[model samples]
Target: MSATEIPEPQVWLDERGRPCPLPVIAMAKAAKSAHGSPVIAVLADDPGARYDIPAWCRMIGATYLGEISVPDDKGGSAYVVQISESAQTDASKSIG
Candidate 1:
């Protein structure tokens, strides 16, 4: 990782058995905790989470930093997503 890039923390939610919305919700909470300056790597096996995570980032004014698919032994895809800072007033004014 570069000095300008803060490596995100990866969380593997074993809720692959629970189904849709729960994984999305968990990812949202995780992202919220990593709200500023760093990203959160949300690895979810739920298919819905692939879309829901990015959508949540959009709704919350955070940057959807893209994702990578991870091979899982449990027979599902793992999504690596990065959530950037929220676009608050002070955040918007920063000329970087």
Candidate 2:
């Protein structure tokens, strides 16, 4: 879906200033505890997140909604992900 069409994120992960892989790792943990949030927005300043976030989403079957640029004070933008219903079902099945 378009960035504008995507819903506001229920889970917000702030990983600004952290290094590569850390942001993605935090995002993964946050996503796991999201409890079916439609969207999870991760604020990361790490350049690797520009690629890792989307890659992680693909690996987990989540939809990479888009990235939203934060103000200069925030350091960088946020990568928004939409956790698909199918993905949630799959996760639940795996846990059960």
Please report the candidate that would top TM-score against the real structure: 2
Pairs of residues at least 3 apart in sequence or in different chains that clash in candidate 1 = none
- Candidate 1 — worst ten consecutive residues by lDDT sum? 87-96
Candidate 2's residue-wise lDDT over 10-95, tens digit each?
77788998998888877766665567546888898888899998887887788898987663586787899888766666545544
Candidate 2 lDDT: 0.77
Encode model 1's per-residue lDDT on 1-96: one tens digit a residue: 332343444555555765778766666666555544455555556777778877766666665565544435665555445555554322234322
By lDDT, the best candidate is 2
Residue ranges of candidate 1 with Cα displaced over 4 Å: 1-11, 87-96
Local distance difference test, per candidate? 0.56, 0.77
Judge candidate 1 against the unseen true structure and give its global Cα lDDT, from 0 to 1: 0.56
Candidate 2, residue 38: the lDDT equals: 69
Models, CA RMSD each: 7.3, 3.0
Lowest summed lDDT window (length 10), candidate 2 = 87-96
